[model samples]
Target: MAFSPLVDQLLDALRVLPGVGPKTAQRMAMHLLERDRDGGRQLARVLMQAAEDVGYCQRCRTLTEQPLCELCESPRREDRLLCIVESPGDMLAIEEAGGFRGRYFVLHGHLSPLDGIGPDDLGLDALDAVMEQAGVDEVILATNPTVEGEATAHYLAQQLKPRGVTLSRLAYGVPMGGELEYVDGGTLSRAFMGRQPFND
Candidate 1:
């Protein structure tokens, strides 16, 4: 059966979201049209407002409504310690984990030469400027465990080498509760390589 042009367009638009297939998009469109049109309207308004007003933080490159993000504006955060992450999502995850009081520099993406995403695209020049202006002493590379993430971390390490700033990459290893038997080979190797002496 064919849906109306408007309904079809909505479904198509919804399908553009990651992991949203045609069936899921259709269901979402139907639910919005039938069950909660008012909520849909509100969602549209909020989405439009956010799209228009939300922008990257001037200092951290993370999404924000103001010139500087809250973290950047906070006086309590450690200014010398800068954590570099591939996205605001990663920064948020680290924040949720707590105990990290340092400032952050969101790359907004990883380096992918094949995809034409270079250092400029990742805003590394801006990062360099921030490091100089903030007098950053330590930079923690918290990019993901993926291949691209590793490459990005290495590239950053080289780029910042001349700056004399301390550089470190986040350790990758088996999950706390994961069993060695079920762990993948790469993860097992990483765990063994990154192992630290157990505290008595």
Candidate 2:
């Protein structure tokens, strides 16, 4: 026989997470029901609270429970250099990578006309307003290297270029430690195309 209605609902809910298939969801549901009901309840409570409370930062648009995220509130962050990322996760990745101490502005998603996403949806108007204010000297576009991302970057460039602020994009290529033989053709091609001159 199949799972009960509630169990099936739990499995379906679990499947909403990225990379979680039916089997994975079932396994998770089973583990929660059989082994750790308390943990599952705690997770549910916290998840509900976070889902209800979390909202975009007023300045950066990254998810936060407060009016401004920690990054935006931090006085230690550079005011003149701003990095634009497609998601909060992307911003986190760059933060974890270290070295760059600039501020960030998150665009929840790239521009997708077919999906009904537009510049307004991506917070371009807010960005324009932010750029209009003094202090931000440069903007680094850290959007993913996809078609939509490219289009978004190009659009931002066109909008921001006239403002006289320097604009830059993150370069894509092979991973630092990966061998060329194992690298994909597309990656290798980009690596070659983005090749930099070595200094003596």
Candidate 3:
């Protein structure tokens, strides 16, 4: 049986979300159509609002409703200590841990030469500008433990070494190849607490 064009369209649109497949999308569309019109409308409104108003922080590259995120604007955050992470999700994970009192630099993604992503693509220039402007004293390379993440951390450390900033990497509590966003708050806090210097 062919689904109505509207239903199909809704399912297709929802499938764009990560980990959502055709079955889940179709189920969600059905649920929205059958019992949740108001909820669906609210979701649509929020989606549109976020798409229109949310943007990357000028300094950290984290998604925010304003030009600079709260973390960047907050006076309590340490200016000299910078924790670099692969994405805003990772930043949120660290924030949830409630142990890191410093600022962050969100890379948005890790280096993946096979996927055609390089330093320029990851906003290395913006990072350099932040390092210089903020007078960053220590940079904690909190990228994931994956191969691509390690490569990105190494590349960044090398590039920033001449800038005279202390560089460190998160401890190995986060499993190999695991993303920071998936690690629990306690583990992430411990990892940050036990970070080791990134030599080389």
Candidate 4:
């Protein structure tokens, strides 16, 4: 027998999450109903609050609940360097790595002409404005290593180069401790193109 209308509706709603399939959605609904009603209610409350309160940072476009994200509002982060990423998730990854101390600009997405996504959709104008205002000396393009991401990075380089800013893309290379035999051809080519002299 099929689920009731309410259960079916919940299942459909759950499936809207990325990578969630029908069976997974059904399992989630069943788990919520059978053993985790309170947890489900808490999840619903937090989700609604986050959806309503969260907004893009005014300066960097990262997701936040204030006019500017904490990073943009901080006094310690370097102002002369800006890292452009494709999403808030990417920004979070860089933060977790603890390597970069510069500010950031979140693009939210890449340029995908086939999907109707463009520079305007990615807020490149806003990025330019921030660069102009902040007097950024260097810009690091940290977009994903995909065709669309490469196109977007190249386009950004062209636009920002005339402004006298030092534009650079994140170095593409084999991961530390990764076996070169397992590396893909494209990555191997990039690593070769971006080769540097031995340090020690």
Computed on alpha carbons, the lDDT of every model, listed in order, comes to 0.92, 0.91, 0.90, 0.93
Please write out the lDDT profile of model 4 over residues 99-176, one tens digit for every residue: 899999999999998899978999887897898899899999999989989899999999888889888888789999
List model 2 lDDT by residue over 38-99, tens digit each.
99999999999999999999889999999999998998988889899999999999999998
* Candidate 4: clashing pairs of residues: none
Tell me the spans in candidate 4 whose CA falls farther than 4 Å from its real position.
none
Q: What TM value does model 2 have?
A: 0.92
Estimate, for each residue in 104-195, the C-alpha lDDT of model 1 and write its tens digit: 99998999999999989999878978988998999999999899999999999999999998998877898888778999999999889988
Which stretches of candidate 3 lie above 4 Å from their native place?
173-200
TM values, all candidates: 0.95, 0.92, 0.85, 0.95
Instruction: Give the residue spans of candidate 2 off by over 4 A.
Output: none
The worst-scoring run of ten residues by lDDT in candidate 2 lies at 125-134
Clashing pairs in 3: none
Compared with the true structure, the alpha-carbon lDDT of candidate 1 equals 0.92
TM-score of 3: 0.85
